[model samples]
Target: MAISSTLRSMGLIGRCFVHPIFDYLVIGGGLSLIVIPAVYLLADPPVMRDFTMLPWFILCSNSAHFAASTVRLYTKPGSRDALPFLTMVFPTVTLGVLTLCMFEADVIGRYVQLIYLSWSPYHYAAQAYGLAVMYCVRSGCELTQNQKRFLWWIAILPFFKVLLVATSKHVVAWHIPEQLVWSQVDWRGGVNLVTEVLGVLAMALPLVLFAQVWLTNRRSMPLISLLVIMTNGVWFVVFPLIDGFVWTTIFHGIQYLAIVMIFHVRDRVARPENKRGVVFHTICFYGMCLVLGYALFNCLPYGYQMLGFGAAESVLLVIAAINIHHFIVDGYIWKLGRGDANRRVVETVAIGTGA
Candidate 1:
């Protein structure tokens, strides 16, 4: 009872994990952003070019997170019936694209890589938008359409900075002639200024919106939701400055794994015919992800290399395909609209001590 009172005082809303602690730390990603980076800085680990070199980390973090969405989508009962095109036809489409990438690793593969890279920041921002709004909706904060538009603008504001960075001379040389690069027109200073402003807006706008909600409603928005917003801002703007790609990706993966497992375990246990405990379901889901992740990231690349593709390009193309495919799969599986199974799972107040 005391714990429940504390949670209410903290503005707890719809939560993925059993307790607020796991939801705030793992799903919210606020605390992990601080703690994980501090540990990494102090430990000063060796730089790893390829994650597959660390088999355990790959199986647990990188590979497992990518595979989690795929596992969740296919394993869910009625998912095929609910999202037939995504569950059935999408795999074939993804496979066809992967094959094209392999055959034209020099041409199609490069574009595929760029597409994945460019789309990733947008994807991360979209997830942040989705999760933050989800908590509000679950907590009975009915947002006006205008309010949603404002929130989305704040969420995607960070992507503009990345877009500007991608167009700079160093990376832009890959596609366009050097003379026509974004920086050559003497727009570098302007671009830098704009990116800096966008970065500040990305971090500050969330706080402004949170305050607006409080003023309008006479109550605070869920603390977890506010944390989710700030955490994404930190992930993209702050962590990237520290470690570039590795920190953001690892933290994003951790967030994904936590939320995905919550949904997977909850759905399994809610079934009347299912008898397994939360721990059992959690292990089984992660174990499946590990096996599939290993196969997709490791074995598939090896097979491509054996067929005469360069090892590096083979890995890159496979990764591009998997990341793009997971992005699409997530778009389908986590819908919260009327009649969506995920709506039931996501909006419920799931308080327990199990998963």
Candidate 2:
């Protein structure tokens, strides 16, 4: 009886809220809420700060994304199977392992600040991997020697970025003990330059690929892909300019807005017709607004900190809400305006016949 009831409850939840949008939002928001607070709570007031929770949160987030990619691989019918598996699934596993190593007490002692420094390159590698898989899957024409050489060079870019980051640590080695010194304008200039260059490359690569796809296919790619690109781009640009973990806090606090927008766009486009059953759209929308809003407003920037919690949270909340609404509405137009699946099938067939 208990099992039956639990199943029924889950059924209802799925019916009411289990769309891609809701899935990502809830997963992202939940992980952020737990991870952000946990990081702050665990950090020692005086000395070595415990960042175990951040890694754990990243693990959870990446795991959720991997699960989503798996679902897409199996359920999407015509989607490229190998690309998503190799790119998304494998990276998630790598990230999970990295996170585990960072958080494990034994491993943490050896690594110290190494994990934090490694995160930027690790993500760049993962993104490069994904882009490479995408390039292979979408390589319609036979590749010439020049194209192959270009591809190889592109593949090596992430490693170069990693090397730059590794070397930048030496820039302020003498001032390592002093937070003020490290944070000083002159000392951090080199670090900023290295980080920004990596950030730009990471952000630009996807946009170039997306532009290529748009020119060739003219069909709308998945919103998740777009979101990933946009988020990374924004992170690369905004975070470096702002220059600190505070940006991370702010980025995370309001990232739910982007998740919500993506969901709203996805639902509008996908427009799953099985309306009789329960639908779980907008879980990320409503849930994130509540949870993230609370965190931003109540918990973040707390006390006599540099940025006041209430002020920062309020501003971010407004921005997030507006962006979410705009994305949902825009997505509706983009997807619904293109018509349903049957229409698209007819259009494709018509194009083929015309050709």
Candidate 3:
């Protein structure tokens, strides 16, 4: 009887803004990254390299997630009035930059691709931090400024580690003549050691902070929040580079799609003018994202290929351009300021869920 009572209390502590299953499995990446890995480890399932080749998986993730934020921005009522510059000018500017990259594929395109790759880890870290704090606030787990600062470092430390290792080689290459890129190699070992230390700290600090928060606040952050932080750490630091990119893009897409859909539907339904049901809005929003994604990732690149760009370069440049645009747009659209509609929607959702 005591064990049963204790287990029930433990379960109640982990309550999420969404239902437990959906929030943990989808938004937190637990099912894909954590559960699947444990299953593979215990059962020793046959390793398949072509899992990403599935057609439905291809259509629903990656590019679809990138398209989601754009869909969210334009679909929200008053978006143009609220964010005139982003809604009006950014798309045209993005297209112009993409055209320049297409014309100078070797020079400008390379730099753009490099920027996307470099920025990706930091982007992931920021997403992790944002979602973690959102869950904390929504769950009524008040965090002091000191606690929030600790959480921020816990979220961002992985990015610092990734950045250090990534730039160490390139920093030397950038400063020296082209031919000396190969010869400059001595500094990497020390940087690698430093990153290794950072990696350990990044992996350890989250658990430490989680315990500290619980002790200090008399309430824990939602378990889903911790799952988010851990999953991001695994993506950047624990997984092999090739595997990390493949998995993170797909799973991160899943995470982004789930949260954005929730916010979009909630916002739409709450408006007095909205005549659409949640089901209708969800289907419509995701359907538009799918079509736009197909056009952006497939049709645009194929068009560039037909116009004489190298097929691989065409694909990569388009991806980089799209990603940079998404990163910039996401910066503005999700702000939680007093005037922002997102804050209202988020607070409403939290209250509705009894979070």
The true-versus-predicted C-alpha distance at residue 189 of model 2, in Å, is: 6.5
RMSD of each: 4.2, 17.6, 3.9
For candidate 1, report its TM-score.
Answer: 0.88
Error of 2 at 78 (Å): 25
lDDT of 1 at 177: 64
lDDT of 3: 0.78
lDDT of model number 1: 0.76
Off by over 4 Å in 1: 1-16, 45-55, 168-183, 240-242, 350-355
The lDDT values for all models are 0.76, 0.38, 0.78
Model 3: C-alpha RMSD to truth? 3.9
lDDT of each residue in 1-39, candidate 3, tens digit only:
575444334433454646788898898888677655774
List clashing residue pairs in candidate 1.
none
Q: What is the TM-score of each candidate against the true structure?
A: 0.88, 0.32, 0.87
Worst 10 residues of 1 by lDDT: 346-355
TM-score of 2: 0.32
2 versus 3: better TM-score goes to: 3
